[model samples]
Target: MSVVKPLPNYLVQRYRGWKATTYDNNKAWYRHLSNEGQHPRAMIISCCDSRVHVTAIFGADSGEFFIHRNIANLVPPYEPDGGRHGTSAAVEYAVTALKVAHIVVVGHSSCGGVKGCHDMCSGHAPALEEPTSFVGRWMDVLRPGYERVKDIEDEAERVRALEYEAVKTSIDNLMTFPFVKESVESDLLTLHGLWNNIAEGALEQLDPKTGSFVPV
Candidate 1:
């Protein structure tokens, strides 16, 4: 028998409520999207943190943005070694198939994945260093970012800096893909990096010229 369980009561009730209200009100739009298909303007790659609501933050409607969420919003260098690469696949589809004009990497403050990476890199979390640990292997993508920020004296500040590096690192890695690099060089696509301060509701955007994050 299939082991997948039904959604919990709260989520079921919430879905019903949404269907009754929001879905009901937007039936025409939903139908149009279903029939015509989605033609989103941008692709947003963000951390899988529950607190970072990508759609809500930008007030984006359904089919407005193609989004992919992963731990620390990381993008690994292009390695076409016949490996199972979910993030890379998503990016490939977005750029090649969907033809998205912009690709945004969104990182957030107080990200658990970023914290875990920080701890692991600093030698405070030995468990994450184990070869068998899936999270450890995944977080290895951010080690270079951690190396850049390891010298920061303050613990909180260092973690925060690492968070920014995560965004920068992903953007840098994105260019490693030949398709992405070609599109960028042809001026057909653009890249953006953003960091959101969860509590303060503040957003900072990366300035490509200065390599700094400034308030948006």
Candidate 2:
């Protein structure tokens, strides 16, 4: 037996409702999208938090953005060692193949991944420090950011700083990819760092000139 399981009844019913209501109402748009390949102008890399709705946030339609979601939305440094790199692969395809002009790394408040990094660094989460910890290994990319804010005395403030740092870290890592670097140098692509306030629904954008984030 394949051991595959079908979706739960609730989810199946929800899908059917969406297909009937939303898809049916936009049949022509959906058919047009099916016939024409997607050419999204921007690629958004965001955290896997369920509350962060990329489409709803931007009021975007079906194919306006190429969005990739992962824990803490961290992007690792480019390492062409022939290893498996899912995030890097998505970035590569979005930049080189899809030719997206804008690459946005959006981090947010109350990020579990950032909390894990803080815990691991503060000696609170020993399990995450273990060599076999997949999350810890993935979070290693943000370890440097944690180090920058580790000395902050306030716990809440420290976590928030790491969240912002995580966005900046991913933006920095994105530049390590040759395609991204070249495109940026040639003024073909631009990188953006964003932090969202989950509670207030406010967004802050990074200002490279001042090296600080300001409300958008």
Candidate 3:
């Protein structure tokens, strides 16, 4: 016999009139949403950090954006292959199925993935089993970040550079998709890069001119 685990009662739980009360407040639109499928206008690639939830940060409804999460928000360098590309697949579906017009890559500071890249760049990785440790693989994916930031002198500056480069690299990878590239060429889709700092609660956007993330 399988033991049943207790489930969260978020559906009914109330805290300062936040939960069920919220549902009650949005009942009319929620009811309509239940009857129809999602139609999001933007696609966001966010880090897999729980504290950096995309929808919550943006106050988005269930169907407002197509979101994909990954370590460091890394988008693998494009491979022109018939092989399955998980990130590519999501991008294709977002632009094709959801008809999203904007794609955003969101990065954050104090990132474990960015930390991994920092450790690797500083020659300080912890012991790993070689053939396959997720951290090792993720660090490998962040080589481009290191390449962009390694020459910097200050430690803090290096981390900041990695944070921004990682976001740009993901955007670059998004352009690899034929659909994304074509849409961009046709001026039907736009790309954006965003950075969030957890400690300071600061948000910085990539300055397309200098490729650095600046406040607001």
- How do the residues 30-139 of candidate 2 rate in per-residue lDDT, one tens digit apiece? 99888998999999999999988878878999989999999999999999999999999999999999999999999999999999999998999999999999999999
Off by over 4 Å in 1: none
For residues 112-197, write the lDDT of model 1, one tens digit per residue.
99999999998999999999998889999999999999999999999999999999999999999999999999999999999999
Clashes of each: 0, 0, 0
Where does candidate 2 stray beyond 4 Å?
Answer: none
| TM-scores, all models, native as reference | 0.98, 0.97, 0.86
Model 2, CA-based lDDT: 0.95
Q: Sort by lDDT, best first.
A: 1, 2, 3
Model 2 clash pairs are none
> What's model 2's TM-score?
0.97
Q: TM-score for model 1?
A: 0.98
Stretches > 4 Å off in candidate 3: 1-4, 8-19, 80-84, 126-129
Using lDDT as the measure, name the better of candidate 1 and candidate 2.
1
Error (Å) of candidate 3 at residue 203 is 1.4
